[model samples]
Each structure stands twice: as C-alpha cells, then as structure tokens.
Target chain A: MQQFKTLKDLPEQDYFTGGSSACAGCGPSMGLKLALKVLGPETIIVNASGCMTLLPLYPNTPLKASWIHNAIENASSTAAGARHGLDMLGNKDMNVVVYAGDGATYDIGLASLSAVAAKNERIIYICYNNQSFGNTGFQWSTATPYGSETKTTPRGKNNPTGTTAVNKDMVKIMGAHRVYAATASLAYPVDFLNKLSRAKERDGFSYIELLGACTAGWNYDPRLTIRISKLAVRCGMWPMYEIENGILTLNKDFSELKPIDEFLKLQGRYRALPQDGVDRLQVLINEHWAELKEYNGQRYV
Target chain B: MKQTLVTGNEAAAWGARLVRPNYIPTFPITPQTECIETLARWSADGELPGTYFDRMESEHSVMSAAVGAAAVGARVFTASSSQGLLLMHEVLYIAAGMRLPIVMATISRGLSAPVTLWSDHNDFLDQRDSGWLMFHAENNQEVLDMMLQAYRIAEDPRVLLPAMVNMDGYVLSFTDEPITIPSPEMVEEFLPEYNPDHTIAKGRPVTVGPPVLDEYTIFRAQNHVAARNALEVMEEVMDDFDRIFDRRYHLVDEFMLDDAELVLVTQGSMSTTAKAAIMEMREEEGIKVGLLRLRVIRPWPAKAIAEALKGAKAVAVIDRNLAPGRGGIMFPEIVETLYHLDRRPLVSSFVVGLGGNPQTEHKVKEITRKLIDDLETGRPRVEWNDL
Candidate 1:
C-alpha cells in the first residue's frame, strides 16, 4: 500500500475522470476519485443500484477501472465473488472494492455486507453516504440524522420534528464484525487517502463510510460541499474515526466541538428544523461524542 | 469409468468435481444440501486442491458470488432447491445478461404455500424464462452426464450463457442408483480451461452489467440469440461427450417412438416410470405406446419434439408441475411446437405427481388409457390425474 501523508504526496495519475451526469461538487464522486488514487487502475468497482449507478450513461463511463453493477442490494456479495474469482485465477494482487450508497450499505445491502465482513474476506468496501436516499429525491434513510427533513419526512402540521429516528451508527456496526471500520469526510483528502491505504494493506474486509455531502439533495451551494463536510466533522456530527482490531482511534481530536447549528444552517434539508429539534439534535450529537471520547484508544464494540 | 451406487446429489457433486470448478459457493437447502456437503468435505480434506468451497449465508449470496467469480473468469458451481432457487432468481437473470457461463445444479422441489420437501417440477419450471439453458434429467446417471455437457455448451462462445441442470428432489437427490462417474481426465479433455476474454482481471479494465438505455433491448436480444445459439452448441457438446465418455445424449430423449401411434411427453424422473408402463402396454395390452422425454426445456427443442410426435395419433403431456388456471405448463409448449407441423398429434394435458406425489406405473397406464380414449374420441382433455 502506497503511503500518502499529505495532499501533494498523493498519486498524480487519475482513474476516475470527467464525463458523467454527477452533480457539481458531488462528494461521492470526489470520494471515488480519491479512492482510485489509492486503489489504482487494477481494481474492480462493484457498484449497487443508486445515484452512482447512473454514473455511466450508456456507452460512456468516467471510471478507468473495471466496474460491475450487480443490483440494488448485492454490491458486497458481488464484490465477494469478484475477489474470490480473482484469487482463484491467480490474480490475487488486484483489488475488488465496493462503492455503494447509504441506502445500499445501511439498509438493503446490510446483511450482504455483514456476511462478507464476518468471513474476513480481502476486499475494501466504501459506502458513499449522502445522508438520505439522495438518488430518489432525498428520501429519508436510517443514515438520515435527526431534525433533518427529507421528502418522506417533511415538516408538516402533524409532525414538526420531521426526521425523528436516531441515525444508525455504521462505524460501530461494522467494527463489531471484527474487521477494520472507519469514517471519512470529503473535506479531509489526506485522512481519507491514508485510511484507504490502511484498508488496502489489510488482507481482510475493511469498511470506510465516507460522508458524501450532496449538493442537489441537501439543497446546498455546490461550492459549500467542502465547507459543509468540514463542519460535519468539526461539529461532532460526522466524527473522523477508525476502529482497527476492536480498538477505536480518533483521527481528528478537538478541544471542543463546534456548534451544530452552522452545519445544519448550510443545508436546506435542515432549514425546517425548529429550536427544540435543534436542541434535541445537539444533545444526541453530544451523547454520541461522549461515547466516542470514552472509547477512544480503547477496545470499541 | 467407475460404476458406483450414488444419489443424484452425489452425481452432481461428482460432475462438479470432475470438471474442477475453481469456485463453489454453496448454501444448504433440503434435497440440495448433500451436494454441497460432499463438495465441502472434499474441500476440507484437501481432495479438491484448486477449489474454493465457500459456504454462503443464503442462496442469493451464493449465486451473487458465483456471478462475481464467473465474471472474473473462474469456473463456478452451486446447487439449490425450491425456495433457495427462488431466492437466487433475481441474480440468475443478471448472470445470463452478463453472459457468465455458470453451471448450477437445481434439485427440483415443490413451491410453498403449504410447503412440501418432495420432488416436483414447479421449482425448476418456474425458472424457464430466466435465460438459462435448462436440462432436466431422467435418472442419476443422466443427472451427472448433463452436468458435464452443461458446462461444455454454456462456455461455448456462441452460447456464453448460464445452465441449470435439474433433477427431481428426494427421488433423485436422496435415493441411490448405479451411475458411471466419468474420470477427471475425460472431463478435462471435454471441458477446456475457463479463459473468458470478457472478464475483469489485472490490466484488463472493462465494465459489466452497466446501465443501458436503447442498448437494453439490444442486450436482451443478444441474450435470446445466445440461448438460441446453445441449441447448436448442444449438438457439438453431445458429440464431444459421446466421443470422450461413450455416453450418448440428445436434446430430447426418445424411447420406442418409431412404430408407436400413442406417445407420452414427460420430463425428469417420471419419464422412467412412464417408459416402464409403455413397455408393459406394448406387451400385454398390445398398445403401440412410446415416450418422448424433454431434457432441454429452455432453447426448447421444438424441431426434435415435433418430429418425435409427428407419427403419433395421440400425445399425453404429463406434467409434474401446474400453472394454476393454465393447466400444465408444458402442454401449451408442446401444442405450440406441433401447431406448424403438417399432421399434428392429438396432445392432451395431464398434470400429475406434484409435490412428490408417487408417479407410479398405475398412473402411467391410466394416463395412456386416457390418451387412447382421447384418440378414439378425436377430442383432447385437460385433467389432473390425482383427482
């Protein structure tokens, strides 16, 4: 695995190029681009049915690496097959990575993902989570944070809280499988690339759920994609952490978390959030942050 | 060649072992569990040196892994029955659409509403439109032989499609019968190393099963054409199988069809019972009865079927599967195939032996007598024999 300590140390050759229908400053697309720098061209990107599935409009694909789109809930199982197949064919050096969405990873494809992780197969799995089912016009998913408003969870007269369900902790769920699990942000390229390198080096399943801050779904300025992503990490909403061999390590430590209001105010998805909802969300974030801090450098899950 | 007493599940496992599939992703299901168990035992004992026998969480993942493995140019094999086959239904089409040559053993069982773990064609026949080259076997020997032929035909460049070799559950899967397990060297001579030019490997960048717009119809047409192409590939594979192992097979198996005026169209293990009844009728009752067993269901052997039943005055289509309001599934297919012939046989529909109902010789003779009556009346009947 090639170590890239800084942005300048990263490889210059790009495998994911221009020419798709991806939204401007598409965080998932950027995550994939940086992932290819770590994975290189000798990789097979197993994609599930989601927004990125529409990346390759017929006869045209931005990815130089091989891509396999199996179905809505089978990117992990499909990647498992590709990894085993390549290994049996004596081409064991090539990478078989899955690039799926939150809907695929946290919801539909969760069983497939857990089974593969339990087996400790040598494959890198990346969940490009944009918070909601962003492809389907911002429908709420289990990954959707509380107080956020997706189309399905609209702030109406009956329900003012909008998204009431607590967000699923994907990192803890994956770490419980005894495989390397981490969280990445599009704002931090070097950290994500370094985690990608670590996942590449492991001869077992490694999961990295990268926060893909959506421009279209979140109704944010395309230019604020990075700012929103950075705010997510700094505000303790989306922590930068990794769990290796049951030990959790905080990648970005802070003296105090920034206010969650700035992160919520930037996205239209949270514009309808009331004062009480905002306070509730802040309490939830603080509670989660406390747990992570207590478990830091300790055996997690 | 070694003649040994084995179950149909063992026969399938032997076929997979002889062909030396590099990957065998499996999940346990009734009637199909022993097949994977045998492979798992071999993998554990180090008897299968190059094989990776992986036990998956479900049949869906088993097939998904198979597609992944086959897409990367590895010979892949798996087995399932009833609901297990249904669970893998979605990926089966994807496997065919991707043109991955995966050979799977489908041990047929009755579908559930009220579940039965016995032999039936519903589970197998339900996958008729999945774009797989379908082969149903009469006995354990044919079960093993078709597995060898399935790989040969599927891997052919013209075909490049997945194949499902099915045998009835319990009767074939658990019951023991004498079969000649072909030598590994013979299978090696017959099936070449799987080296697909379309797979994904190092330094070879290609997209598979990508989203297509107008080209969706084109890919579907190609799927249909490739399956149709397997009709020719079957002949070549049959010839090679005969030359290598001296076991001759055909797209449609015929028994006493030359001088017979009464014919019974059957499939799977029930054909053996039907053939026995036909012989007793020929000797005692003096009824000139024969049987035409449908081996290949997909890429339906329409020509062979028409020619086989051309001379018959009446044909009884005995189906071990039912289509609810639509009588027997194969009854329509047979009638459709014979429609263009100059002299079509009087084909009657008979749905029987569902959910492993014992397909006794008594029922066979009764069906033959019904066919005789239908011929005399010159009017066909659609009836369920169990009633």
Candidate 2:
C-alpha cells in the first residue's frame, strides 16, 4: 500500500460531492468522500437501504462512479455479484465496494456479509457505524454501545440504563475470517485512507467500519463532530486499528489514555449515563485496550 | 441438435450452458439441486469459460447476487424450488422494476406447512403478480426450449424484463425424457449477445433502483409496459426460435381445439395426461373435448385464450393449485378474459393436484365428463377432482 504523507496528498479528482440531504457534519458523508478519493471513478458502489439510500434520490445522484442499491441487508452479496460480473466481463481492474449502515452491517446484513467474508470474494465492504439506526430516528441497533440511549432503548423507571448489551467486536469477527478487517474514524482520514489503500492491494474480502458520528442522533454540536471522533480514540472508545491476515496492528497509541467522561459528555445519548455506568464502560475499554496492546504486531486471532 | 435422455434439471442446465451466461448464482433446494450441481461440476472442470459459477448461502442471496451481476450488464441464470422460490420473491420484483433481463428456472413444488416435497402450481403461480414473464413446460424438451426462448424474449430492447421458466417438480425434475440439446452455434445464431444500454458500466455512472415518492408510479407503469411488450416480442422470438430449431411454440398450446364442444385448460406437465385423455374421448366416447395448455402465462395471453375457447360450449379450467378460499387460481383469470366475448362459454373451475397428487388420464376423463354435465345443466361447478 502506498502511504500518503498528509491530507494534501489526496488526489484532486474527487468522485463524491461535498454535501447533500445528510445532516451537517455527518461522519459517514466524510468517510464516503475520503474512501472515494482512494477508490476513484473505476469502482461500483453497492449501497444498502439507509441514510445513504437518499444519496441517489430519483433522477439525481452525487456520485461519479456507478452505483446499485439492491436492498437493506444484501450489500455484501450484491458486491460479490458486481465483483464477479466485472471479472466475467474481463474488467478486473475495477473495484466493487459496499457502503452500508450500522443497522445493516451489525444486525440485519450480518449473515449476507459473513457469506462474502467466508467466500473471500474480491470486494470491499465499508460499514458506516453511527451506533444506531439513525435513518429511522435513532432506534437501538446491535451496534449501539452500552449505556447509550436510543429511541427503542429509552431509560425509564424500570430501566436505569438505556442499552445494557455491549457493541459487537466486529473487527475481531472479520479477523477470524482471516481477511483484512479494520476500524477507522472520521478524525483520522490518513489512517482510514491508508487502510483502504491496503484493502485495495489485496485480492480478497475487506471490512472497514468507520465511526460515523451522528449530529442529530448523538445530539452533539455539528462543529464538534471531528473533536468527538478524536476524543473517541483518545479516550479508548473507538480505537484506530487494523487486523490483516490474522496480524493485529494498533495505529494510534496513547501512553496515558484520556478519561471516558470527556467523550461521553459531548453526546446527549450518553448525557444520562450514571457514575456506575461510566465505571463499567471504562473497565471494558481498559480491558480491550490491554488485550490489543498485548497482541499488537502479532497474530491476534 | 443431439438427442439425449436427461431430466428437466439437466435440460435447464444445458440451456444455461448453451447460452454461455457470464454469471450463475445458485443455492441448492430439492428438485432444483441437480441443475446447479451440474453447473458446479462443469465450472470445476473448466467447461464454462468466461463464466463465474457462484454458490450463495440462501435463495435470497442467490437472487440478490443475480440482480447485482445483471445490473452491471452481465447475463445471469439461477434456479430454485418451493420455499427457496418464496425467499427469492422479494428480489424478483426488484429485478423487473429495474428492468434487468435475468432468467431463472423454477421447479415447482407445493408450499410448506406439512412440508411436502412434491409438484404443485402454487409456488409458480404465487409469483404471478411479480411483473416477470412466466412460462410453463409440459416436457423436458419444452423446458430447454422455453429457457432459450426466455432469454431471447427477456433481453430484447423493447422488453428488458426478467423471466421464470417453470416445470413440475419430481415428475419433470427427476424423471428422464429424450430432449434435443441445441448446439452452441445454433443458440448463438438464435440469441444475440446481451449488450444492454440501461445498466452500470465504466465511464457511464448511474444509480439503479433508487428511492422515489410519486415518481414510483411512472417507473411501475414502465415495468407494466415492458412486460406487455413481451407479448409482441415473444411472437417474433418464437418465429426465430422455430426458424432455427425446427420446433414451434405458441402463446397458448392448442390440441384438438377445432370442432370441439368441451375444452380443458391446464398447465405444466399435466397437460400431457390431459391430451392423452382427449384422444380416447374423441375415439370411443364420441366426446368432442379438447385441451388448452397455458404456455405463456404473463402478458396474460388473454386474446389467444379467448380465440381458442371462443367456439367451445363449456370450458373447464383445471388448476393444479388451490388458493384456500379462492377456488382455482387461474379460474378467475380465465373467466375474466372470456366475460367480454360475444359467445362466452360456460366456465367451470376444478382444483385438482395439491402436493403432486397424480393427475392421471382417468382424472382428466372425469374432468371432461363433469364439463359435459356443466354444458347440459348450463351451470358451472367448482370441484376438487383429485379428492
């Protein structure tokens, strides 16, 4: 993979438009723009039904690359078909990439995506993880982190915590499939682009889940999207990491990780988090961080 | 053409192989498994060059992948049966709404609740409203012929729609019959290479199957127009198919319709048994009963159905499927078509086979005798014959 020195190293030819109907400071829109920079126009974007489905709302689209939206839960399999379709047409240089949502990736589309990873089809799957079903007014999804409030997981008299279940360790699941799996953040464009470049270099399946911080769902200031993303990594919440061919690599490592309070307080979903909830979240993050450090630069799965 | 003994599954696979599709996405289900197994073996042996045989996890993914491949302008073929066909029902509309010309072989089986692995028309007719061109075959020869014709009719510029060529399960799928497999050279001359203009391609960026509000009506109307276009396109396709292959097929199959007072309307392989009964009734019983087998079901073939039944005194619409409260699924469709005719014959509905309860010559004779009774009484009856 060719490493870019800085953000300016991105090519001038962009395939994605700057803005559309998406909320201001949408992390997924940024992730898409950056990913398109690496993928270019010789690619087909297989989109699932989500917020991104509106990107091509009848008679209008912002993409210079070809796109197909099959359904909500079959983006991975659709990409598999597109990949084989191109290969059969004797156009192997083109890329097949998927842009799905957290609800699509972590829940409804899991089986479809797992089949692709198992087959090791030549495709790239990008899951824009906003932690909930943000398209449907912030409903709880399997990707929703613990202690976070969503429409379906509202805290009431009987329930002290909004969501009690932990987020899925998706990167580990893909790593076990022995393919290229990674976690990226909107705050780290260089890291995400670098991972995408590496994924393009491989001739098999790749899963890259980006931390798509939602302004409306998370109830944060539009201007603080990048800051919140940065804090997520600094607080050991969203780690900048990649697992390739069973080898784990931690991209951003902090000697003294910041406290989780700074990251939680910025978003309204975590505003009502109790002291005990914060303590439990911290313990979980610390344990995961310790495990990553131990397995760094080694076979992790 | 080479005359060989093969099952309906093998015939469908041979059709796919002769067409040389760019991709085939498949999953295994009983009665349809052998079709994909043949493709898989050929793919492993490197017989299918420039083609990718993909094995997907489920029928839904199989069809999803077919849509993805076809959206990129690659020819695709797949097969499924019963519950698998039900699972693929959602994407079938998407394939047609997007106007992707994909072809699939549907081996019909009864729907599950008791889970019978036998042939019935419920699985095939359930997709009647799905905006796909539908065809049913009576023998292994027609199975292969219809598949080749399906691609021609589906991929025409005037009709960029998907098609499903159906044959009865167990009876046709597993049983062997002599079919002439057309040569690849003849198939090439008959069906041209699929060069679709409405798809995703390099330097031609497009968004397929996007969301729309009120504009949804216009797109759906286009799907309807295109499927209706298949009615005309298929006439030309059948002509070309006959000119090259020396075999003929019409929108509706007519057997002994001339100078007949009683007619039986049927579909799939049961038409063969009904035809045998008609000959016996003509020779001994002095009954002028004929048969009308529905070969082309969608773009409904109403005019031909009316033309064939125009002279009959009473018509019996023998359905191999039961729609619960509704008598026979095709009963209303046939009745509605003939309602406008000047001499509208008395139409009776008979729901016969449910889960491969055999449709025999005696059952066909009984159905004809009942139609004679309806003709005498001037009243139509809806009865379950096989019960």
Q: What TM-score fits each model?
A: 0.99, 0.99
The CA lDDT of each predicted structure is 0.92, 0.92
Tens digits of lDDT, candidate 1, B1-387: 798999999999999998889999999999899999999998899988788899788888999999999989999999999999999999999999999999999999999989899988988888999999999998999999999999999999999999999999988999999999887888888988888898887788989888888888998999999988999889988998899989899889999999999999999998888888889999999999999999999999898999888999999999999999788999999999999989888989999998889999999999999988998899999999997
As for candidate 2, its clashing pairs are none
- Return the TM-score for chain B, candidate 1: 0.99
Q: In candidate 2 chain B, what residue range of length 10 has the lowest lDDT sum?
A: B200-209
Instruction: Write model 2 residue lDDT over A31-110, tens digit each, in one string.
Output: 88889999999889999898888887777778888889998989888888889988898778998999999999989889
Task: Report how far residue B190 has shifted in candidate 2, in Å.
Answer: 0.2
**Residue pairs in candidate 1 whose N, alpha carbon or C atoms collide under 3 angstroms:** none
